[model samples]
Target: MAIVLTVRDSSGLKLAALATGFVMASLDVTVVNVAGSAIQQQLHASLSELTWIVDGYVLVFASLLMLAGGLANRFGARAVYLAGMAVFFAASLACALAPTAGVLIAARLVQGAGAALFMPSSLSLLVFSFPDKRQRTRMLGLWSAIVATSAALGPTLGGLLVSAFSWPSIFLLNLPIGVAGILLTRRCIPPVGGRRVRLAVPGHVLWIAALAALSFALIEGPRLGWLARPVLAAYVVLGFAAAALVTRERRAEHVVMPWNLFRGAGFTGANLVGFAFNFAVYGGMFMLSLYFQHARGAGPFLAGLELLPMTIWFPLGNLVYSRIAGRIPNGVLLTVFLLVAGVASLAMAGMSTDTPYWVLAVAVAVANVGAGIISPGMTAALVEFAGVAHANVAGAVLNANRQIGTLVGVAAMSVVLGTVTDWNRGPGLSFLLLGGAYLAGAAGAWWLIARSERQARNVRR
Candidate 1:
């Protein structure tokens, strides 16, 4: 009994260490939304520059995640995780001390690279630490809860920090978290052995180039005009890079992406769900944060407070998922949660500047609850499909798709905001887009996931 208790306590510590990395990463994703206006005003940044500041980290993070997974497989997860945390710590300091928008954006890109390194390895470590399926699922739930809590706190905390100090305070918040994560990880998590894996360098380079071109086209198109030479060139570059990436991926001996993973219907569907989920949730969050501050004339602190009702439900939803995860089929759960989010988001599409705050809050809260549940559900589905052998690669693929969704979502919202000019119309239209993304996820879940589960059950019978 004593030995069992000791094992459980040790596992708990390992879980905490893993959660720390996610908490910092998830916090940065949302916290920057609240800090957008502040960063813009302080840096004297244009709207496009502000978008770059936000997307720069995600762009790099998304691009390198698959490579990070390969690195973990080659160099051992523990070593790679530690290295990533150290990089993140240094980059966070650079971000906080950045003197201008260009410097901040550059630092953010580096910070994203660090996050990419740690993010996939953290999951690989978690899967290693909890070998039992039931235990791992439970830990995944708790992990999601902890990370969701940080995401929930991000905007409010950023608001308070920005209100009291400055925009850089948000980046500075990561310093202590990074230090604690590194220390706890070193103390609690045991090292995992690496296998021989080929790291495809050229494939990753093409991937980065493709994403950069796409980002430049999406972000700069509004400011520079879609027909501008640079914008046109970026589109052309994006097309060429994407074609080259596909061709290389097909021919590469060592591919960054594990193309074989998508062979399972469940895996393909789960990736689709991941992409749409992030597209809607992160994009909607970005839109709402700006709407509260720029449209409703709320200060940073007030905007944070106003967002509290919407953000707080994420943890609650995670807790609810933990309770019901075993009882319900993942496919059913995913479908229902996504439908709830989609309908709620669509309901918000009619909102005007004069719409009742409570009404908007209620709808957003519902959508958020659905989103929160979808996060763990989607993760568990993908992980189960991949099994232990492919855990790291599966995690990387899901996260890369999600981050790409994030990049596109934010850029799409930027386009909406830029083109519409009217704050009221822009946010409503943004919700419309969010709703469509969620519905698309629901369709994927229902068609692919549900059918796959049925077929599997029939085979067993």
Candidate 2:
């Protein structure tokens, strides 16, 4: 019994280290938001420049994810993880000292390249670390908990960093964490070697250009007016280019996303559910943070703190539900979680500048719990639905869907949230519109999960 306990404890510790790696990579996902103005002032960035600073990183990170995993397999996990941290640290330093917004955005893209290197490897490492079904489920749950908490807490942390130090302090903060993580990674991780394939250069170039142009168009379209000639032109060119890229990949010797992963209904269903889940969460948070500041008269730090319930309750929910995961019906669990979160979002729609703080807190807390349940459930389902060999690509596909969902949410918000902005009600009607969308996301999850379970059964047979 004591020996068993020691093994379990060691597994848990490794999990902590791995999960922290994930959180560190993800911090960049939102930390820049609160510090955007500071970077702008420090670097003398323009409005367009500031927009690219954030969007560039996201586009690179999203596009290169699958490619990074292939790199990992060709190289080794530990090497890739360490290289990523080094690149991340180097890029962060360059970003801090960058003299212009264009330069800063370029540095940030390098940073994102590092992040793409790290993100898929982190998940792959976790799946490799714990082989037991029960422990794997639990660890994945813990991992998701940390991710959700980080998103909710990032602006708060960024606010504190920016408040006390300069905007550069935010990126500088990664040095110690990266250094420590790298040391731990080298010490603890055993070297696992496999294949060494050549990088698919043409595929990389095509996809990167496609993703960059596509993300640019989506993020810029609202500000530029969707029908603007440049935006329309960009949309047209990228659309055709992407189709061509897909056709080319179908015949490539080393393809990034194999054509048939989606042939399994389980993979398809899981990806759909994953995309919608992240879409609803990220979109809701984007809207809610604005509401807290613009509608409720809160500062960035205060608004982040106001959402503290989301940070605290998510892990708690993940721990509880994951323990009972298999016993409960998968379809019922996902459906209930989404329904509860959507309903909580609807409740939040009624909040105003004068609403009780505690009421707002509880609504977000409930939403967090629902999100907590959905994340691990979705991740585990996707991995299990795909065979072990394809887990890396499965992660990539899941991430792509996640970004797609976010894009869709962003587009919808930009289009419809204008009503509130036009009325000078800033966050009021925006919250209601987002709430309705969250409900729609819940419906999507329900439908896809039903489809997923049926597919799982068919595969088993």
Candidate 3:
């Protein structure tokens, strides 16, 4: 009875700590977006510099997540989680104090490294903390809600911080949360055993190079002209790095992205959908911020308020979907959600300077509902398709792909808008491309779902 009560008493504190880490991770994805204008003005940043400030963090975070998972497995999750929080806290301080775009980008990179360490470890801790199926589901549901809410609310929170204070306030916001999470984790979470795994060094190096070069080429392509010598060189480097990554991974026994996971129908489809989701959604969010501020001439606070429609639906939709997630087939749910998002993108594509705010709000709200639906379903499909032993690595790969999608999405849209002298045409073109990508993702999800069903029937026969 005493043990049961202790578990019950400490569970909430543990949940708070774990969710704090996740919130910090998710918040950074969008918070910096709202602060873009302020950061630009204060630092006298170029467009490429601003892009790097945002993409640099995600690039490092995505590149190192797999290695971070391995580290978590080698060291205990509790120890690694605390260490990650400490690093994240220190990095946040660095971000808040950065004086130049170069300094900010470098700090953001270190912050991503710290985030990479904690994210997977925090998930591992959550899994170990709740051994019971029901409790696990509830905890996961709570975790999902918190993460969704953070992502949803990030822009508004960032706008408020940047409006009332300055851009640095955005990074400063993470300080108190990080400190509290570290203290709670040290006090409340129990130590768990870890496994020994080999680090895939060659694969890591190749991936990091490939992604960084690709991002650089994409961001600089529009500014430098696509065929410029530097842009061409970056593309060449990207191609070589990508080819080498494939070769190195194929030959390695302990790989960062195990090719076998891709063989499963649901796993492949989940990753594809994850990529498309981030590409369109996050990219669109960045574009929307620019449109509101630059094109529409809205202030930071009002621009965030304009986005409230979509943000509000994210958490509410997640709550509603969690209740039905078990009853629905993941493939079907994923397909439907992708379709919804695609449709929303299409709706947004018709916008012009004359387009009313209500019309845009409706379209964005639909997309938020799609995001809410797909997030948890993607996780479920990964676990179901990969099985328990492979779930961790499967998740890391999916998330990495998702972050790459985010980088590509943002860079691509920025390139389009940057190159086109006409604001009226360029932004709309980006939306059209995003809509097409979302539909392609929907088709892929449907194919995987049908294949899985057929395989299930064959097995029964």
Candidate 4:
């Protein structure tokens, strides 16, 4: 019989260590948004620059995730997890002490690389430690709850720290957590054997180049002129790289991604939906963070308080949806919630400078209600479609795509808001654009899910 770890068991320490890392990764997603205004003022960064500051971490994290999983498989999850913590520790310190925005962005990149390394391996440790399926599910449930709480608390926690100290405190806070987590993991988790795994070098290179070039082109086009040499060159690079990535994935035996997965009904659409979901949700939150702070003249504490509804409702909505998910059609659930979220986001576009705080909060809460439902459902669909053989890498792929959505959302929002120097008008226009994108994604998801259902019925008949 496989040993089960409860709170009282020594093996529970392994769960604790893994949870700590998850908290850190999850917290950073929203925490940095609360600090956005402070960082902008302190570092004298422009809109596009600030967007990069927020997205640079996510971009690297998403890009390297698959490779990180491969590395962990080849070199053992424990070793990779420890090394990730070490890198994260050093990078956090660097971020805290960074003298300029460029330096901070560089440090954030490294921090993301570390997170990419640890995030997947942390899950690996948990699964390896808990051989019993029921026990593992319960443990994962606890871990998921902890992650949700951390993400929800990020803005409030960041606000307090930024108010009491400065923006740097957000990064500095990771230091102690990292140290404790490493110590616990080393003491609690037994070492697992490594396997031979091939790295997808070509796929990685193409994807990185394509995403980087596309973002750079979009971000710089307004300031540099769309037809400017640099902007044109970036677009050219993006097109070529994206084409090459598609070709490379199709041809490679042991690629970073499997092209065959795209053949499944709703598979590609689900991934795209994941991207759009995060683009609207996370990207919108980032935009609101700046709007609350800059245009409304709210302090960090107040801004965080204002944004609480969105964060708080996310997990609550998830919990509520969980009870109903099995009873309802996944497609109907995904489509309905996405449509609701999209419409609510569009409603937010109507907000004027004179709009009341409570009104804004209500709108954000409504949007998050949709997010909460769709988030878990999205993962379930991706995993179900990918099936068991590709199960190991399914989450990684979905998350990577979701992060890419974040990167694009932030970049797109910046492109919209960056064009308008006036803060008051920028947010409303950006919301309108994002709302439109979300609606399009919803339609796509609906069609994809319907097609998948149709195929399933045909098979059964």
The top-ranked prediction according to lDDT is 1
Off by over 4 Å in 3: 1-10, 449-461
TM-scores, one per candidate: 0.97, 0.86, 0.94, 0.89
Q: Considering only N, C-alpha and C atoms within 3 Å, which residue pairs clash in candidate 1?
A: none
Each candidate structure's count of clashing pairs: 0, 0, 0, 0
lDDT of each: 0.89, 0.68, 0.80, 0.79
* RMSD (Cα, Å) of model 4: 3.2
The alpha-carbon root-mean-square deviation between model 3 and the true structure, to one decimal in Å, is 2.9
Instruction: Give per-residue CA lDDT, model 3, range 77-137, as digits (tens).
Output: 7777788888889999999999999999999999989988888778767766776655765
Which ranking of candidates, highest TM-score first? 1, 3, 4, 2
Candidate 2, residues 191-210, lDDT tens digits: the string is: 54647677777777778777
TM-score: which is higher, 1 or 3? 1
Full-model lDDT, candidate 1 = 0.89
Give the per-residue lDDT digits (tens) of candidate 1, residues 1-461: 00111243477788899988889889888999999999999889998998998899999999999999999988888888999899988999999999999999999999999999999999988887787999888889889999999999889999999999899889899999998999998788767878787789999898999999999999999999999999999989899989999999888788869899888999998999999989998888888898998889898989888998878988887888888887887888899989998999999887889999999999988887766688899899998778888888999999999999999999999999989989768888999999999999999999888788888889989
Better of 1 and 4 by lDDT: 1
lDDT of 4 by residue, 229-325 (tens): 9999998999999899888887788888766788876777788788898898788878888888888999998888888988896667566655665
Q: Which residue ranges in model 1 land beyond 4 Å of their true spot?
A: 1-9
Task: Evaluate model 1: give its TM-score.
Answer: 0.97
The window of 10 residues in a row where model 3 has the poorest summed lDDT is 1-10
